[model samples]
Target: MKSTWIALLEAKYKNLKAPNYSFVLDEIGKNPYAKVVEDIRRGFSINEDTDENTDISFGYVLFLAPGRDFLLRISMIAPYAFLAKIKERGSTSQPIVRENTQDAMELDVLKILESHGISMFDEKSLKIGVPDSGKDSKSLYQWMFVDEEIPPWS
Candidate 1:
């Protein structure tokens, strides 16, 4: 039987969605890793031309373990519209902005999981780089370990 934590995570992903975009969930059950990837492709209109809409692909991968440990990896490929906005604001500021945004988003996700009694172990923000898609590169963030009991504050 699936544990309560697993059930909660599953329910959360199942209900997750974005406006005007559908999500796809891919479940991977392998040794030492029971993972679920939730993906979405969002369309943005950068120009008045309808044919110029760009699609941004992003997703989160959730890793479940046997005990009270879990991991989440988030990847986002910026759309042309988003890149344009960043460029308009000054291309040099993109890295800093992206890092801060990813950190904020990771914190939010951790908070949600914590509300379910999950404690964080380790967290990391991967360096941004080009993805196989050949579009804009992606920013990756990962959080590892989810415990049922909260750790004592130092």
Candidate 2:
């Protein structure tokens, strides 16, 4: 029964957040793909919440490079989808100087979604979202990624 775009992409993958990979691992510090990465995760092929009332949505940011199976998905003009539609019609009309309101995707208004036949973004079935502890993902990536809508990344 879980199909309103997989419950809105598992409610944005349980609001996933585990970002700071030390500035892209210090710019892949020595760039041998950081000596065969064994970890780094956040992947969801496509999430096109294409405006019923315009809250803004688009996709492509999968960087699940575990062990160099690599997935440097890109296509950004995002600045957080118009500040996540101004934090859903009301929140940050004032306080934000780009430390990260989660949408440095600027304002593409939800393009590049390539229309429902979908394309690319299967860097070999990547799925990594964790937080049911480690202090509930330390603030807001309260994870569970869909275990029969599991909210647990089953």
Candidate 3:
């Protein structure tokens, strides 16, 4: 079955022109199809255009710790920000939440961004954090937000 997050993203931006993907491609380097070895790893969607290259679909993040395939519900709680619980593929079950908020799904994503030098917010600022383009963090943020601003949540 199609991922709910992906579907919602597609539905919302079906009419907009596609975004430039070479930006992300430049980051992943020649190994677009990098080998998958880690049992649990973080990945950004780039193979499929609609997954991350759309004009508004800023990011498509996946986790391989327990499984792959999940995303923020497309309904943004704040401008350029999306948050919601995630269910297993094809199962309308409860969201996967752990006792430690640090181990939370959202944290998983933030950590990946952090690894790339993106805090997702600048120090003492509410605006969406700027990323190092050379690190291709800009592309990742592009996949995360359509426009930069103080996320409504703050």
Off by over 4 Å in 1: 1-102, 123-154
TM-scores, all models, native as reference: 0.19, 0.20, 0.29
| lDDT-best of 1 and 3 | 3
Instruction: Give a tens-digit lDDT track for model 3, residues 1-154.
Output: 1243234333443421352334433433432222321211434432222233333433333543455454432212112323223355432222222222455545665454434433232212222222323332332233344443333222
Q: What is the C-alpha lDDT of each candidate?
A: 0.23, 0.23, 0.33
Q: Tell me, what's the RMSD of every candidate?
A: 18.2, 17.2, 13.1
Candidate 1 C-alpha lDDT tens digits along 44-93:
11111111112112222222212212123221111111110122222212
- The TM-score, computed over Cα atoms with residue i paired to residue i, of candidate 2 is 0.20
Please provide, for model 2 over 3-80, each residue's C-alpha lDDT reduced to its tens digit, 9 standing for 90 to 100: 432343334343334332122232223332211111211122222222212111221123212221111222111112
Deviation from truth (RMSD, Å), model 2: 17.2
Error of 2 at 154 (Å): 28
* The candidate that achieves the highest TM-score relative to the unseen native structure: 3
Off by over 4 Å in 3: 1-54, 66-69, 72-85, 88-100, 104-108, 121-154
The 10-residue segment with the lowest total lDDT in model 2: 138-147
Error of 2 at 30 (Å): 12
